[model samples]
Target: MESILATMGDQLGQMLVVLGGALAVGFAGSGSAWGIGLANEAAAGIMTEDPKKFGYALVLLALPGTQGIYGLLVAVLAMQKAGLLGGGSVALTVWQGFGICCACLPIAIAGFYSAIWQGKSSAATILMIAKRPEQIGKAVILPAMCETYAVFGLLVSILMLNGIKL
Candidate 1:
């Protein structure tokens, strides 16, 4: 029993290592899932309203999911930092681990809101497309505008993760 207790104490110190990596993988992926769901829902609604608008809605809904991919990149980096890749000491401090988490936060936060906005706008745009498919260009412009923020979030995450010591 004492040996087991000693092992548990040792593991306690390593918890941050697991936590930092988990944060990156879990939250980042969820952000993407949220975006996908909202966009999909909006696309479904638009498709029911106007079947011809399918292509445009599909692209718009997919755009938000790109942010999730950015999160996944950071997660992979975190695992590398934790030495799950080549088994070198990353020795990530609490502050460093926290910073990594912060790096992923923007994508998770910005992605959640922007996806909904894009989805709704896409739904509206689908109507315009149904009326005139040539107007699809203009309809896409709104979601394109929303994409700027997701891009910024991805950029920030990439920059921060680059600095993490592995």
Candidate 2:
């Protein structure tokens, strides 16, 4: 039984590697997409009021998108260590492979949810700003509050990878 488990782990390691990478990419990208969506929606709304702010709004929307990039970076770093891009050549243990997969989950899950929540939050703030421009700073700060953990998650994944044998 132990031998079978080990064999399965070895075989599953590759799958986990790919899965982790995909999850990282998917999770972070989803957040970015939603953030971009919020920005676009806001831009459309703002453009109706003043077209000059379009560029500024675009930057604001894209700011939340940095989370996804961080997730992707962690995934890529893990994959690189896994030799997906020809870096990791060592044989990975079941524990190591499992750790690699687990490491990615934090940012993926956090980024995915936070971005969406932030988007809605952004929309509300933007709307509030529409009524009173003085609320813009508060609006911006609100979404940022959600983004810290996603960044931390990304950091965790990177550190987790750093400790992995891969």
Please name the candidate that would achieve the greatest TM-score relative to the true structure.
Answer: 2
RMSD of 1: 3.3
**What TM-score would every model get versus the actual structure?**
0.73, 0.82
The models' CA-based lDDT, in order, is: 0.64, 0.77
Q: What are the per-residue Cα lDDT tens digits for candidate 2 across 1-166?
A: 9999878777777668778888998988888798769767976898799776665565457666877887788788877877778755657665677788888888898888877777766666666666666666786787788788787888888888888765
> Could you tally the backbone clashes for each prediction?
0, 0
Write one digit per residue (lDDT tens) for candidate 1, span 125-155: 6556666778767877876787788677667
Query: Local error of candidate 2 at 64, Å?
Result: 2.7
- Top candidate, metric lDDT: 2
Off by over 4 Å in 1: 1-31, 86-89
lDDT, candidate 1, residue 124? 64
> How many angstroms is residue 28 displaced in model 2 relative to the true structure, after the best TM-score fit?
1.7
